[model samples]
Target: MDERRNRMDDARFDEEIAAEVLPLNRDLTLPENEKPRTGREEEAHIHERKQDYAGIGKVTGIAAVILAALSLFILPVFFGGAAVVLGFIARRLGARSLGNWAIGLGAVSIIISLIFAPFF
Candidate 1:
């Protein structure tokens, strides 16, 4: 009968509409339980980077001084060579503090080593 056909067509149309409109992703169906990440992780990441840069500068500066002193004793006139090497490395690594410190300490070490080299 015409009435029955109309009813069946209406049901089929609703089913087709629901299939198209419904979300295909199951994850979307789930309720949003997880909250956003706290600032702790971001803060820690920033802190670690700051500490890392500071450490690099400190260690390289100290090493430059040591190398300058040692090289002056063993080698001829290779003054501040180690410092120059490390200072360049620091610069390349974007360690501005460390590179500056390395150059400064190396200069001081070279001067002191030169003054003392004559004695030893």
Candidate 2:
């Protein structure tokens, strides 16, 4: 009686395994005309605008450099201050090279003004 019960359990387990495995293999062999309805196709068509801070920072950095250059001739105190502020802003915005240049130029202008103050 135990041997007979073991045979019945084995048969039930084999049926359950077949039920789970067969459908997966069948789905994998789908025809070209019968495409699966995954929502990924719609997702693939979506066009998202990427975030870009480099361009904005670069432009601002350029402006800072120009302002710093102008500071030498115009207002060494005021334009230099503006340039320094813009350079720091540009650094925060991601423009490393131009921001550094602007900062250096502004600082130089300010220092020159300070040096000339004793003579004048």
Best by TM-score: 2
Please write out the lDDT profile of model 2 over residues 10-119, one tens digit for every residue.
63434334544334332346556645556776455332211267778889999999999998887898999899999999998888888898999999999999889799
- The window of 10 residues in a row where model 1 has the poorest summed lDDT is 22-31
TM-score of 1: 0.36
Which RMSD values do the candidates have, in order? Answer: 17.4, 17.2
Error of 1 at 95 (Å): 7.2
User: How many clashing residue pairs, candidate 1?
Assistant: 1
TM-score list, all predictions: 0.36, 0.56
lDDT of 1 by residue, 1-120 (tens): 999788865634443335455444333352366334479977887778777777676676567656655654555246466776887676655566667766776666667777886797
lDDT of each: 0.63, 0.80
Clashing pairs in 2: none
TM-score between candidate 2 and the true structure: 0.56
Candidate 1 at residue 42, lDDT?
Answer: 72
